[model samples]
Target: MSIVQRFSKIFFYLALFPAVIVLCAWQGWAWWSWATAPPAPKSSTGETSDADKTVQIRIPPGSTSKQIGSYLESAGLIRSSNAWDLWVRWLNTQNKGVFKAGTYELSPTQSLKEIAEQISQGSVVQISFTIPEGRNLKQMAAYFESQGFFPAQDFLAATKQIPRDKFPWLPSGLPHLEGFLYPDTYQIASGGITPKAVIDIMLKRFEQVALPMYQKNPQQIKLNLLQWVTLASIVEKEAVIPAERPRIAGVFTQRLQKGMKLEADPTVEYGLNIQQTVDQPLTFKQVKTPSPYNTYLNRGLPPTPIASPGKASLQATLNPEKTDYLFFVARYDGTHVFSRTLAEHQAAVAAIRKQRVQQNQGAIPQPN
Candidate 1:
């Protein structure tokens, strides 16, 4: 038609073309979203088999999220690194890069989302080990080594490196850390556990449990923290029955109060480097051994604790049983009879010997 009419028509077409393109683009985006959005993951069920991509990923200390994600993918615990990264970012966990260094047991049944959540939340596998009361440091070190916590030599070396000043409770110039490592079951990660870390945790536990007792009755007992621990250690090793601990502690306390030699067999054994039960009765020569730890000569608690003490022994030290008994001997059964006089102690020992003789006769004799 006319020029003005043609120009108006062209402008209208141009504008309409842009609107059509905009509408198409919007529709395309909607279609793409529908196609690409992931399906809601199925809730894990009992039917899931253990064989489904089960892997243990060890995220060592100081590892970054990128490193952790790559490790999971390599271990086949997750399907895609991108998915895991996005899932971790969305969770906004405080454990951002602080994934506790550990050997985590992971399963293939777990989605990338679940795996990421677990890692970020420190859902790592835990290993537990218990140190029984009365165990010496060497025994404790052996137990740790057996549990794969650390090398036994490493534990021993770490004890040497421990600063005496830091632990004022410890006696000076001690050859090794013997009775100080408190005995208790501990939960720790199976990976990245250093010797120092293990020792530090045990020492802290010791302080938490034993320090208060020392503070409460320091002077009344007339023993320093280390001396108290030393006495408690002897009590731990000597008393087989739980009920007898207080009585044994009382005997020691009485001897200490009277300035009499402790003459403890365990102390003599410790001096002689003999930890097991002696086949023969202790002789005067055994008691006369020249060691700083020999209670027979020292006339008090040894330089340090003979072994680590448990709560019962510690309590016995704090509250000794009031008894006139000064000597005790183990009966053939798992018990001990106490006596006050030397004559009474001799009679009890004779009775125990007689019982042992009868027990031997009662048993079936092996072909000799």
Candidate 2:
């Protein structure tokens, strides 16, 4: 209790004050961590229900770690992009969260670790339905029905009710959703895939496939989305040879620029709605059909696409071969003879008719 002893004791308490404060702060932090830390992710049997929260998130090809993390975050499958990035860096996962790009079935309840592993594996299971090129919406619908998938009527209804507001690139006053359903193989990623979702998927794929071209040079293609797809559908229906797509695209492009009637036979056939095709010559009356879809009667491109053009046809329409040839007549052998002059086109048509006559004769040979 002497002055020297009291002063020494005060100095000792002051020295210990900072340590006491540090210990108290550490203890508080530990209590908060224990109180607020996320519970351990419950194990799932990997079975997905038809919950609205669960969705198929597509990790675009070649997406960086940050890009993928952002997508998952937006989809509500991850907490946040920054958290995902930090976690991925900590795990040093396969490619460090630069996951394999594909459509993945994801749920909010899944642990970040489980999601990362599934994506790194890159397994897109389920069925893939291939929509072939040059098939009209009705034909496409029929194919869907034939496969015992969605009913044809339901498929058609979805096409009729495309959420165009969701797709800004899709122009207004489209003839119908005929040509926009991009022709490709799409996997049914989930058990709850509905008809409307299927339509959205096709258009989304089209956007993924074609939006970059338009975005790169919006003015390069002189037509809007509807017009471009319309012309491409015609070219898709006309071009039989794989190599002839560009040439066909060129023919349509030049004709559109010159203000000439397309004179495309497919347009006339579509106008007539004649389903039974028996490899016979069209009657002269069929050429003069009075329908909006008939390019022969109408002066410009059809109001809507006649069929779904494949990616090649769409690309060809956007970037044509840029030729002077204005006309083409289909030969019997899935090829066409190109011509710039009317007389040349007529001669090509005549040659095809003669070839067909010879083929018919050969089929019915005279017994000698």
Candidate 3:
């Protein structure tokens, strides 16, 4: 009964140890699991859209899973704190710095699974706003203000407050955010969507999108990053057709290299400070109105970006197409006609004017 019985008993307990631990874990999860049943159909109010029914809850910085769960329970989003705790441990979203700390939009109507996934991913409630290419910072400020996202004055002020040291991608010596806003559709959390927050996120997004190309070959970018963005901003306004960006970029590059005037129409328009903006066109005299921003009068890129340049325009400036073309004329159909020589450019200009004249003329009908 000694050796054989003892060894058999030891093996039985050892095998049972794992199973017991597994059982304990299962029980612990069950204890923490949300006990609430599915939400009823009519829980939302008539005034609130289904999307608007979510209650805003903030997870304070450095909050533990247990603490987060307690907060959720207090907010009445979950059945109990322990239930939320259990769900967090099960999902492993709160594991080893994976926990996301931010204000979250959650509803009691949502399943524990959905809440866990949402918070783990740090998905916050966001209001979307799009920045169109070639829009200057001032224009952007007014647009955001009109949308009630933030005050235009506050937005402009926040641009100067951004910590340049934190972001290597952003060029220093710029007076304002200007070209770096990186025109794109952005979503921000409803309540905390500050102008500073928008600028921060967009700067990061710009870094993410543009840095790769620069990192590949910094020398390929002929101009400094800030200057390149400035030039790209001008190109953004010039090229309406997406296919023409690289070529338009090429024409600008050629002009720059030859020490010839850029003579870009947008630069002059920007310089004139047109109150109505692009809605109003500049007269011929405004093009000759000398200003630092006016490429027709200036030797190089503007002191800063004239407007926000999109990715296509940015890339175009970074790697301008190799071409001899130095001039371009806008056509009536929102396209450009590129010309390599002065004579050729003059011909294109005359053709464009004739087309516009034809477009403006009213056809005469013979009397019946």
Candidate 4:
């Protein structure tokens, strides 16, 4: 070993040692900083508006950790995919929770660990929507479309293919799920927001809330399930005021008992796919139009329920207000004028028409 050769080798070894230490230190610092730093940093005003805003990210089933990390990085939820990989490796060593597939509401302000924990625990976001009472299938379909849930016709088609296997109590040969879909606010995981899923959930809710009402049959209304729902649907459309629901149901019941025509305008509108606006009402020709749903022409309940009635309307139909009144007319103020005879009904109709004419400069109203 010559002195020059040995010294040169020692120097080379010393230089390499410092370089390795500096490189290791730089890598460690980078790992720590990335683990702690948020994707969206705070502004000079100390407000993290962008960081606070949540983004919806869906993790498909069977995605690997690498794929998930890349997804998070692309979504701007994580500072770096490499840092996420390191964190995942550490988590794997600890045998922590497994990542589950779902729709997540993630924010940029969340740390890598926080986001990872949320996804691992399957903390999925749930989306909710409300179906107001008196909305028929077509209206409901349009509503679903407006909310970007599904196409309108898609929902309409789903309604036709009734899920009878799961719900055996549904009346056989139902043309469509018009009256049975109980209306209410429903919350479901975002990943499961499909047409069939919505319909099944709504049907299940109907089974839970309304089916029992008929099963108990406290009032023992002679009407079958289909008949009860049909009558309640009529009451729902005609009676705007909550208090008038029972009275309206009573009128329908009396007319049914006497075998007279129901003469409900809503039925004609439903059949014709038209709405009776304040300026334009059902015409004489429209009323005389032959349709199965035209209660003005048909002598019984409509073929199917015109709309989905609420629990209150269903209860009102079952235990209607016992009255001798056989007819009623809407005053356009969420109130009705009840009549027991043809003359009284005609007079009340005349009074409403006269009031409309006075309000609108002698404009005549369409005949009932």
Maximum-TM-score candidate? 4
For model 1, the stretches where C-alpha displacement exceeds 4 angstroms are 1-55, 59-75, 80-100, 113-123, 164-175, 217-220, 278-288, 364-368
> In model 2, which regions exceed 4 Å deviation?
1-125, 217-221, 275-278
What would the TM-score be for candidate 4 when compared with the true structure?
A: 0.84
How many clashes (backbone N, Cα, C below 3 Å) per candidate? 2, 0, 1, 0
Poorly placed runs, candidate 3 (over 4 Å): 1-124, 218-221, 275-280, 363-368
TM-score of 2: 0.64
Model 2, C-alpha of 339: deviation from truth (Å):
1.2
Give a tens-digit lDDT track for model 4, residues 23-137.
9999999878976577876566766576688999989889999999999999999988999888888898897658988789998888888899999888899989999999999
Candidate structures ordered by lDDT, highest first: 4, 2, 3, 1
Total backbone clashes of candidate 2, pairs 3 or more residues apart or in separate chains:
0
Error of 4 at 245 (Å): 0.7
Point out the worst 10-residue segment of candidate 1 by lDDT: 34-43
Q: Least accurate stretch of 10 residues (summed lDDT) in model 4?
A: 41-50
For 1-368, candidate 2 gives per-residue lDDT tens digits of: 99999999999999999999999999976754433232234346555444325568877667887888888877767665666676678767435544676678777767666677778777554667889888898898898888766799998878877577898778776635888888889987544356887888888988988667655643434987778888988999889898999898898888888999998989888888774243775677888868998888889998888989887888888888879999998887788999999999999889888888888899996999
TM-score preference between candidates 1 and 2, better one: 1
Compared with the true structure, all predictions reach lDDT values of 0.76, 0.78, 0.78, 0.89
RMSD of each: 6.3, 13.3, 11.5, 4.6
